[model samples]
Target chain A: MAGTDDRDVRLVAYADGELDEDAARAVEAELATSAEARRLLGIHRETASLLKAAFPESRYAGGSLPPAPAGRARPGPHLLARPWAGAVAASLLLGCIGYGAGSLWPAPIAAGPSRMLAEIAEYHALYSRETRHLVEADASEAEHIRAWLGPKVGRAIAIPDLSAAGLTFAGARLVALEGQPVAALMYTRPDGLPVAFCILSAPAAGRGMLQAEREGVGVASWGDGTHRYVVVGEAPPERLRHWVGLVQRQI
Target chain B: MADESFRQALTRLLPRLRRFGMTLTGSGTDADELVQTTCERVLGRAGQLRDDTRLDAWLYAVMRNLWTSELRRRRIRRHEGIEAAEAVAGEDGAARTEDRMTLAAVRRAMDSLPEEQRAVLMLVCVDGLSYRDVSAIMDIPIGTVMSRLSRARQDLHARLAGEADGKVTPLRPARRG
Candidate 1:
């Protein structure tokens, strides 16, 4: 009982200045008489100082890396942004795939929906389950998001209102796909299921909404005069189609 | 421009975040990568972070969550090839060459700790975070944070005194039949 874990916790918390004033004064009074309490407190404080000393402040800031915007892998700039805009949606089948997220599928360097799915599978990897990190740009600032991404994506992107489909816009971010920038918009259902809608830039390959499934994830894609839209997630087939219809009509 | 405030906070916290990342990942490149990803997540989710929250604590929480997610991806030693961890302090100066040895011992004792203990130690002892802040960051209760810190400090003292890295050279061995 003299040196129990419960006793040590109070002593340690006091030493670390974590206890409130009253608790700390109690620890201090107990420590004033017992050499053992003083000794343990000293040891913990010494260890704390040692940890701080070993890692000095600003050790990395004295003219080191200038805040690299990101350290994620990026390919050469020469590689052009491709037409199939839905790079990340194909991997959003996380609810159904039930495997690990961000698994690198060795999709060969080809074109069209298959290639885009493989390229941006990583977006869904980190988009795994963090509700907050579901997107880069908050949906509240829809106008600014459109302004920032439209030019870079080389198309007039639309922020479709998916509220009728019971989906709320989360946010959007520009993701790289096959060495090109693609816009990935995120929405979530009340049940906390996340769905990604990606719009890619390309020429007039006009079509209406079409339904398909790839790699166990539901996909609905359509191409307009300037971009291809894809909505991907793991949902009932008809439900996926219904959400796709909502996006199609709004955009 | 929308993320201006978050970006400034991130820049201010880069060193500490990177140090914490290094302690967890044990590689400079890996730590920087982890920090950058954490930064992106923080700025990306800037909406979720209310003005009342401390940015430093939020950055740490995001980084810790990212590291945890990565652990699910690859299961192995979290601080692999960390023998070079002490080399980071070498730039402090050459005047205290002996103190550098002490630093190395301290670092080794730290790494030898269980992951849970070491993480709590770094958060509480090194970062000077209150137990409550550490609890919020680690998502554990305040009492748990205190016990872990107590255990980690005690373990570090025991290890560095004579048991670990030949720090004391064992005058006559510390075992008995």
Candidate 2:
């Protein structure tokens, strides 16, 4: 029953205790005489109550809270709490101090194997559940996917065969890593969980196998000095390792 | 503030930060992530924040900025399926009790609001921030904050009332209450 008048805004402000005494008294005076104003004020209170109920902090009490980042304790620059962030910090520390002395540093400080593992896991978390946009190219286009992404990545980007590991090829997409092209092969288990094998051209430093798990996803990165691979999935460590092993042999 | 004192202050703000994140993301899981990211940003850029600045407003601004960038990234990643995912999150086992069902409906309607209105509404109604604080957090004028908050509450009231009436009218420029 309230009109689009200044009193409507004033009534809300007054109800929310947002007004000074003078304006609040003005609203209270209008409320005492105007039935429409009273009803509108009631609606404002009801709306605020509804909003509090809808997004109640008490509803979130049961959920666990992540630990305060160790950055608070560290003397240096504050760091993000994610597991991979620690890895990045370690890599940076080593880079500044000169690792391997005469030998070239064994990893790219910017996006090392651990960083790649973290990134792949995050990608799986975001896009693995998608149906329509699961991949840029479907499984039927395996040859075309290879043809499309292989040259761009400067390597033979083959979609791995994991049939023995209970995964069927879903599709592949050409993604970018550090301004270089990479290929991601998407697969789905019979139970509908997704797995991806990301292939990138890494420098001589980006070699060897590194395994890390984050946010319920198991990630493993390995490369033969020229080509690096990271496999990400929601499976247990053994299962993910088995699948990654199979894919590694195939690729 | 000293590093130890700043960290202690941030620790105390966690619950409010989580609540604000919940309002912005509309998903409990995403809210947790948003809170973590917000804390990380706050600590990482603690030097940038003035000691005299309002810490709560600064934190809310950081969370809002992060959510905006996250939306932009999601838009680039895909088009159709993101909404479906959000829908699934809203209805995920929280509707068993009737009260929870009503709350869920209210949440979905709030989720449908424009981000500006939702931000202001939550800051004022849920977090109980003053209009001046919300204006600072959202980088808008106090007049804009009031108008946005009034419009938000009006829209929410109509949407909830419409749900009870079984009409489910599409949200529009709400008429006078």
Candidate 3:
């Protein structure tokens, strides 16, 4: 009564049996006095009765359930034991894996002749190794690494100077990629965590870069007209952005 | 104790549960899938069901959530596989001849109602659940449940009435040759 409308709300409450003892008496008294109120009550009662009458009967009569579809066996122990069932299951699993792999990897032939594999392999090689002072050039000389690697890949490659990123440059490396040469730059945090940057010429037109993650490692690859670059590391995605931005500006 | 009781309760409720699923989905196949998924989810989280008395509400909530998610996923996949046939014959024409249009329309209307309204209407009208039982199942104050039921009835009445009115006036007449 406090939050509800007096007329419409009271009738609804009365209809739903929500009116308490005194409230019910008051409503009944009102209904006796007001013919219109009684009519409203009648309509409410009729609507409620109609709704109840229209209520759908239970579809699943205890024993009237439809038989399982033809050839679609019930999920019993024997169903799983059947050779055909096993074959069907195996085929379904294989189809799912194949579909996922096809979407992810695409046709290797359609991937175009590029240094993607070599770059990924290089990134894998350097970061996977266990050593200190593993980089040829220290983080302090970010400019030198950019200049040295820029001309070799036939692009103005800039080693994303990320000293502020809490990661120090471990230096860059020249690696053979797709019969042509490319650059693989390495970086690490003070705690000896590693990140790799691989840059080579871009693949053919209409080809998009791919990103993949495996075993907590994120590998992001992209290609501009001149060069394709992949940054592989265990750093948080934001840090990866910093490295990508550094490469983007220089290239 | 709760888990054992919940399992027993679910098994007992399975028949009614399947009926609710069938009414909601309008397809026996889809209903079976919905019931199976609901059972699996309830079984998987058996330990989390603390109150044996509130098992019906818990199961209904799980079923509702699962159905909503399944509908969303189906919307994405519905575009493929039948495109060519659907494109050749328009959806309206195809639906008109199928005898499924009325049921489909009813289902759509029910689905389009607000979740609270739909739940109340479904429980009270479809499942024949008493207002007291609905209040317990929804875990709502009985007054709130009553309000929802009132509003749901009004909305459904308006929808059904509008459909009837639209049908009374024929938009097209048969041509005499």
- Tell me the TM-score of chain B in each candidate: 0.82, 0.71, 0.53
lDDT of 1 by residue, B54-114 (tens): 7778778877777776655444332332334334223466548788777777766666666
User: Which window of 10 residues has the lowest lDDT sum in candidate 2 chain A?
Assistant: A92-101
lDDT by residue (tens digit), candidate 2, A72-184 = 52232221222232222222111111112221121111112234334544567777988678899999987899889888867887777899988888898876544556688
- The reply for model 3, stretches above 4 Å from the true place, is A1-6, A62-251, B1-8, B22-29, B44-52, B68-116, B125-144, B159-177
Which model, 2 or 3, shows the larger DockQ?
A: 2
CAPRI-style quality class for the chain A–B interface of candidate 2: acceptable
What's the true lDDT of residue A72 in model 1?
A: 38
Docking category for candidate 3? incorrect
Interface RMSD of each candidate, angstroms, one decimal: 13.7, 12.1, 16.1
lDDT of each candidate versus the true structure = 0.61, 0.62, 0.50
lDDT tens digits, residue span B54-137, model 3: 666666766666665655544321111011111211234433444344443343344445556666766765555667777776
**TM-score for predicted model 3 compared with the true structure:** 0.39
Chain A TM-score values, per prediction:
0.52, 0.53, 0.45
Off by more than 4 A, model 2: A1-3, A58-182, A186-251, B11-15, B18-37, B44-52, B65-96, B169-177
How far does residue A149 in candidate 1 sit from its true spot (Å)?
Answer: 35
